[model samples]
Target chain A: MAITSDLRNVPLIGQAIQRLCSLAALSDIESHQIALCVVEAVNNAIVHAYDREAQHEVQVIFAQYSDRLIVQICDAGHAMDPKHLAPQTASPLDFDPCCLERIPERGLGLAIIRTTMDEVAYTTSHGKNILTLTRFLKSCQPGSARPEE
Target chain B: MQLDQRKAGDALIVTPLEDRLDARVATDFKERMIELIASGNTIIVLDLSKVEFIDSSGLGAIVSSLKRMGGRGELVVCGLRETTMTLFKLTRMDRVFQVFDSEQQAVSALSGNKG
Candidate 1:
């Protein structure tokens, strides 16, 4: 699924990912969580990689196997700094929840992805960047999930 | 980005009409809350009963609203879906704001605090 670097289209992409996750026999919570990870990755591509420029392209490719799901978000905008690829440990989640001022308002996207997805990898070459997320399916069976075309 | 609002004494109960309150409408949600607060609707009961999905951006917007309120007002959450609640717990935000099961309970808590 390809969408312009726009926030308005994120929910639609999330819904589609949720449906696909369900088809792979994931539970409702798992479906929602995985969908969220994909959404976060896509948001990174749009907001960071493309600098929120709607004219740029962000491509999301979903591949499901017997035991796992892999999603690759590709962008042609500015390559993300390698340090930002991995989620930060010092995030709003690490702070005392009661201390409102201690909690940061933003930068929760990548942290949520790291918390939810089993594996996260990013690669860039020749002005293109790709973020790959993989989640192993606990209840996956042969033929349950369709292979990528 | 429709919000169903009703006044329960000094508290305002705001329910998001949409099922998904992700990045798409998070900013708008925050701005609406700010608008209400600036207009003297201080004690807010954010009813999340209709929100089936919420992302990090949505969570950030909720936090921003709380920050906007500062110490002058209250921002309590109610009707968190199981999925959204899980996200709250993951971020430990469940401890920051008081959470209730329903709008009535939230309103009751606010009323009790005011008294």
Candidate 2:
């Protein structure tokens, strides 16, 4: 479903995320992480996806499978050029530290979302920018430690 | 959602900030406080009575604003809701900030303190 960019929309998004997380039976930390990711993603769609002069709706889809929780945030503003959305990387030692401090708040939203979710993907199709985030429900179990690569 | 501001002596008393102080509204909050500080109003009281939530970004913004005010001024927060207070405690920011139970209390505490 789609919602306007009002603050009230946050609770609806939270509810939707909670339902999916419960269905996946995620741990408290996992659910909290997913909720944080959803909040940042939705906020970005509301503030950055559309130009202020125009009205736009953000579409959210929650899909739960046997092993994963999938969330898709789609906006029909200007299609995001995938190349322009590179993940933020740590500064190299040679780079000026002051430059990092001056970076605008917009860049941190995507980084926070990526760091909180297990899997993240972005694509643009037919003038729609779809950002998908996935959390593998199974990997979080106590005994299911990381397998040898 | 609710905001209250008043003046006690030379200090500005801001109280009962309701709603989540999250990334969505941190900028506006920071700007308002910073503007007040820049207007030569140093002693400030932030009454977070109704605030129910705050995240890391929100906490960071508040700390950054406090730093901006420098050692010459004081920024004190009061009446933090239980959940909001928990965040401060977890981040150990409660140690860094002087918190009070009411605006009057904060004003009284910082009244004599000056740079």
Candidate 3:
């Protein structure tokens, strides 16, 4: 399913993500996490990839396998460097709330996507910025805490 | 997004009458908070008992509102669900803002501190 790069249409995408994950037999918590990750991905495409330009289209595709689910968000916008998609080295444990100079205001969308999804891959193909997020259903038990290790 | 605003002792308690605080309503929430703060309601307690889901944008807005308050004002939140609490913890925002279990408890804590 494809959606415009508009924040207003995000709820509809979220609803579709939830329904698709649920149909794949994922638990409520698992479905919710996946949906949130998708939202982050879509938001990033709109804000970063397309620069919040109007008339741009963001395509979303959901594929469910026996053991995993894959969600791909594609946008025909500015290319994102693959190196930038790597997770940041900064751990939340190292974050100091009082250190106003060090606190990061932006990039939480990428952080949330990286933290929630099992595997996140980003690339630009044929002038399309593609972000693929995969979740292994069997490996991650429903309602289980985040794998800190 | 309707905000239920009322006075509790010396502080203002504002609750969002919505189930999810995501990208759609984040800006509205932040704007409303700024308006309240501008109206001299510095000591504020945000009641989130009815909110079940909050995205990063919503969290960012709340943090922005806190920054807007600066040192002269206080912005405390209460009645967060486990998922919402987890977001704050993961983002290390739990240390930035004081969170309570109940609205009354938050009001008393802030009121007591002021008194």
TM-score of each: 0.92, 0.65, 0.86
Expressed as tens digits, the lDDT of each residue in A32-108 for candidate 1 is 88888988888877878877889788888888988899888889988777675445545546887666687767888
**Residue-level error in angstroms, candidate 3, position A131:** 0.4
lDDT of 3: 0.81
Off by over 4 Å in 2: A5-8, A27-29, A81-88, A91-106, A138-149, B5-16, B22-28, B39-49, B55-64, B67-115
Residue B56's lDDT within candidate 3 is: 79
Task: Give a tens-digit lDDT track for model 3, residues A1-149.
Answer: 77888887877888899888887778877787788888888887787788877678988888776567889888998877766566665543456788644455556766777777889898877898789898888754445232110
**Model 2 clash tally, residue pairs:** 1
Deviation from truth (RMSD, Å), model 3:
5.0
Ranking by lDDT: 1, 3, 2
For DockQ, candidate 2 versus 3, the one ahead is 3
- Clash pairs, candidate 2, are B1-B18
Q: What is the DockQ of each candidate?
A: 0.70, 0.17, 0.47
User: What TM-scores does chain A show, candidate by candidate in order?
Assistant: 0.89, 0.73, 0.83
Model 2 CA lDDT for position A20: 63
**At residue A102, what lDDT does model 2 achieve?**
36
Model 3, range B1-115, lDDT digits (tens) per residue? 8999999888999999998888778889999999999889899999999998788788888878887777688899999988788777767788888999999999889978988
Poorest stretch of ten by lDDT in candidate 2 chain A: A91-100
TM-score, structure 2 vs. true: 0.65
Better candidate by TM-score, 1 or 3 = 1
